[model samples]
Target: MTNALTFFEPTRTAGLERLRNFAPDAGRHYGERRNYLGTAKNPGAVSALSPYLRTGLVSQSEVLRTVLDQHSAKDADRYIAEVLWRSYWQGWLALRPSVWDAYQADLKRLHNAVQTQSGLRQRWENACLGQTGIAPFDAWANELAHSGYLHNHARMWFASIWVHTLELPWQLGADFFLRHLLDGCPASNTLGWKWVAGIQTIGKPYLATQENIEKFTEGRFAKVPGLATQAAPIPAPPHPDRMPLWNTGQPDPALHSGLILHEDNLNPTHVLDAAGPIAGHVTVMATADQTPWQMAPHVQAFRGQAAQNMQNLLADRIGPAGPAVTSALALKQWAQDHGFAQLVTADAPVGPTKALFDAYDRLPDAPPLVRMRAPLDADAWPLATAGFFKFRKHIPALLARLS
Candidate 1:
């Protein structure tokens, strides 16, 4: 039931086909009613594309391109904006890496503090186990545990409840979500948790209430008692000076290409297409300091499958990297042994994979790293330098550029 296995079901194929079929309708409908959680009896009108997109079965560009082809710019604008939100979060976190560091530091501090406070630990454990004694919150908690899915609104309210009402550390709550949610993303998860705690927006923490929950849930959840209102105020981490984009160097058709698969870029077949003639391809997934807790068995199995799929795809071109290696020292050793002077991969933005590449990128004699930026991100990230409004203004031009 992990996110990985949840996809690849017949349901996922149907879901992708649904996106292709009703995209126009979905886009237009989502434009107007994206925020409305229809009823407990019916899920919201949102296209549940995250699981597929997360696994690289469908690219974001493909999804957006398909929608735009079916609907007018005027009608599909809101849906497009929603898609760009992922880009905004990624770019925002990338430019301000300190926010991530601060989150890690605060999470460590809070985790230690929670160990000393039995009352807080018990509440947190209860929250994790969906035993918080609050009907709506408990329901969502169980939903996440059982189904690995939560409606967008439910996630916000759940996060708000954990941070404000329960008086728990926001990072712990965010980590809990990241570990459980099928679409648990680094940028979205980190920024989202910060947003709930008032750190991302500066003094504007989200607060959940029985009234709002009932309103959104269409009265599916009505009675809940004993929720706190105050969220711990976390200061916005100071923005880091924008680092100039490192020259990935020119793509050399003559050089052999090696591959590194990170969570950010789960699929490499697309890059292999662009890599021209390759002497060899080595698929590597280094989960070395990836502490997302015990990953579900399905997740582990899916990674194995993905690696096999990648290897099968590249069988004619080259060989796959053997076993999962979790050390920088070993990575360098492998790179040297393979005689690959250039490593081409799908770009990993602002995540552990990116961090690993950053370390490798700095190595004096390391191979040339050519990370292919997805068309969607390459177009959207520059717009993200400012606010969403400014970024929204570029949509027409952006889509036009794509065409």
Candidate 2:
């Protein structure tokens, strides 16, 4: 019943193969067709490396460098911006972490409203089930549910419809995407929905017109009826001011250390090289913690298998790494088993995995978890203090640093 298996191969080799195959078209060809909504089986202009990039099977530096090798930055401008957008979102969330905290609180408050209000509950259920009778929106809802993905344009249209046309709570829509999307991250999914509703950029909500949908979809659902023509901004407090980024934690080589490998960064060659020899390693997965509802089975299976792939691929360097655990308590127990002095790991951005570690750091018996951040992130995240346009101005400099 799952197309996720065939759609994405869940291996580094597969990702590299995709990148090389798509590099030839990384120029003007990409910009021309990037917004076209083709079937999931045919990734029109997109690279389809998102699932890989999401799990760090392929790094941004690798992808960007490969594309730049094939074409100049001016030629691949749109494609380059698309790649950097992921980092921009990650950095934006990292700097203003309170945004994540506020989102968590909204979900809690909204869940109670969903439970108590029957009329609202029915509308939300119908929307999730794709039974709202809006052709394009329903198709997108079904597509996301069945495929664990949607074209970037489709996501924007779907969110705009969900918030404006359907008049549903944007938090629920974001949660639905998070539960299903294989490549979903807190920064992109949450803030993206907010932007559509005008919370992220105040009073500038994105609207999904029927004509625009028909155009991007190549006339799939012509004359689609009842899409929202105008979108009003959702009221919200301004986002928190920017905070200082954390310096990369240096894993003390002399101490008895074990690497805590997680879903955040599976192929952390930089971390392993920097962390020195490890006593052992244990794995942790926070996928199930993304929502109170059951996660899509494919989402769970993909990451579980991806972790297995990493363990096998880097077996020599990641010595004794396996036996994945799900919670912070289990991590504490693993530390007890080895009585390690320190735990080295990839620095998690603002997500469920980070939330788990936030809990771990508070544990009375918890050992120090040295979060090794990539130099790329350390260098780029600081520049994300302002809006994306300001961040965009530094693209040339960022690309230069990659070399």
Candidate 3:
């Protein structure tokens, strides 16, 4: 892939333009050739709209609506399914948030393991640095490190190698991608690695064979060797019982409130429409809260700048805009000092931003927090009670509602 910085602009304007340009291809063309891996300069038939979609710059509903305007639902079935896969992953994690907690605990344990186990540390470093003897795996590691993006097919192949072939801990592999990928999200990245490891689906592990890689890469990579042929399911506890979805609260029109913007949802048009006026505005940077270790410099820089970009976009609506704050305490104090009765923000799904809000809500003397979820999420999340196939049965009806 080419330099990620060159392709992704990390702004709402850039995201919408990219969506417009890609709308025409979100049909048969996408279904036919989306799997072929092309160089970063070309990127094959894929939309490459993930960085924007991941941050809610261009929402899933907006993307689907734009594509449906150009093509029928049947024609765009594959493309639409791919987009909703993100929603499925999110809703799945939201209900079973314990999985995320377990991942964090496991990551801390492995981090300590790397400190004491010299050989393990060296092997982990080599895989991350793309120095492992496997040619295709090494190339992908280099591509990810350089571009901060990878073809979806390539991500699966890389994860398979990391888990089954290289025999490295899956959490470390997930962390490596989270540190670099411009589109990385907690729910998707964590569950995706779990899915590849056969834990998410329970015994349906995805193995990347040499033949499949050679075929998918269109002969760019052939003669690869030393891949694991068979995969056994990773041991894991059964899925936790589903929790009731949280209800989005409306901003009280009578109370003085402050609108808070974060990377999870840059466009707060719905929130502005719901809340009559704002007393003050603040932006929170929660990228640091995504992981215990320091986030990659590029990841930190992108999120901070994205929040700034959002502030500039909503300047007219944001009265008394303040600088970005990083902690839950800082956010609580900011709201209190601004004399806000309630703090309103776009409801972040299960991720780092949500984690931050969870902390803020627990703080004593914290201002009331009003989290307003988007109409799309409100409609789609509840349907994800089971696997994607079961949830997928409702796509046509969901698309009809959007119309």
CA RMSD of each candidate after superposition: 3.1, 1.3, 1.6
- Give candidate 2 misplaced runs (Cα > 4 Å): none
Q: Please identify model 1 stretches exceeding 4 Å from their true place.
A: 1-4, 7-15, 21-24, 38-43, 228-232, 235-241, 268-270, 286-292, 302-304, 310-321, 362-365
lDDT of 1 by residue, 1-403 (tens): 5343443332334446857755867556786666666322244677766655665655677778898788877788787777778888887776667667776677677677777999888988999888978787888887776555577888888898888887777888887776665566778888888788887777889988778877767777776667666666765655566654334433566776676665555555567677766655544554324443554454445445655664565577655554454555556667788888787777776766667777777777877788877766777775667666777788778778767
Identify the superior model by TM-score, candidate 1 or candidate 3: 3
What is the model-wide C-alpha lDDT for candidate 2?
0.86
lDDT-wise, the better of 2 and 3 is 2
Best by lDDT: 2
- What overall lDDT, based on C-alpha atoms, would model 1 receive against the true structure? 0.68
TM-score of each: 0.87, 0.97, 0.97
Give lDDT tens digits, candidate 2, residues 1-403: 5788688878888889999999999999999999999656788898988888889899989999999999999999999998988888889999999898888788888888889999999999999999999988888889888888899999999999999999998999999999888888888888899889998877889998888888998888788788878876677998899988755578888888888777878888877888778788887898677676778888888888888898889888766864688888889889879888988888888889888888888899789888888777877788888788999999999999999
Clash pairs, candidate 3, are: 1-40, 2-40
Worst 10 residues of 1 by lDDT: 3-12
- State, as a TM-score between 0 and 1, how close model 1 is to the true structure: 0.87
For model 3, the superposed segments whose C-alpha errors exceed 4 Å read: none
Full candidate order by TM-score, most accurate first: 2, 3, 1
